[model samples]
Target: MAKKKSDGVNKSQAIRDYYAANPKAKPMEVAEAMKAQGINVTAQFVSTVKSNSKKSKTTRGRASAKKSVAKKPAKRATRASKATSEVSLDSLLNAKKLVEEMGGVEGARNALSVLEQLMD
Candidate 1:
């Protein structure tokens, strides 16, 4: 007699098949469906599997893949862009390092001003 295969063995592929049958099904819905059929799985686990599948199918490296993401079409600008008021601690430290590299903040500003003048 052949040994029985464990339900967990193909759980991710099962989830994908379920998604194909019900295009609108969420990860939680997939988990619930599997539970109804006596297969135990959590929604989070299903989500992780689905995400991993997507990441695996991407042919491009991370940087190019990120850049290729589709953006919404431009809309009319009704308001001026707001300046960022808060700086992250990490960003502040990075900026401090950059300033040191350029001698000081004044030196950095001078370099930026030179760049701006060149752009004009």
Candidate 2:
């Protein structure tokens, strides 16, 4: 169906204006008031506008910040778990063999200290 032309007045805006004037007004009351002013709006539409306005006011930037902060911790945990899982048994065995070839863990540490000095 073709859209009906607006009578130059927005129904949702009318509902919001009425709600702004009467913050404690019920949806049915707002609907009745709008009907008296020749704006055809339902109580459900008024309720939806009121709720959406409240949600917009409450969640402006805080909600997005909260979501980003929450996601970072979960991503960090995923990265930590991935790092631990990537250390395979074969890699561990190779590391052990290297330590033994260096004579032991203490000897490996000493050798690493010497290698670090050489790299510098």
Best by lDDT: 2
**Residues 1-120, candidate 2, lDDT per residue (tens digit)?**
999885798888888888888999999999999999998888998989898888745457524434344322111122224546576555566667658657689988998899999999
Give lDDT tens digits, candidate 1, residues 1-120: 998776445777788788778877888899999889777889999888777766745565533454466654444433333585666665566566557658779988998899899999
What is the Cα-based TM-score of model 2?
0.49
Give lDDT for model 2: 0.76
Report the C-alpha displacement of residue 70, candidate 1, in angstroms: 23
Which regions of candidate 1 fall more than 4 Å away from where they truly are? 1-9, 56-120
Candidate with top TM-score is 2
Candidate 1 lowest-lDDT run of ten: 72-81
Candidate 2, superposed: residue stretches over 4 Å from native: 1-4, 57-63, 70-120
Residue pairs in steric clash, candidate 1?
A: none
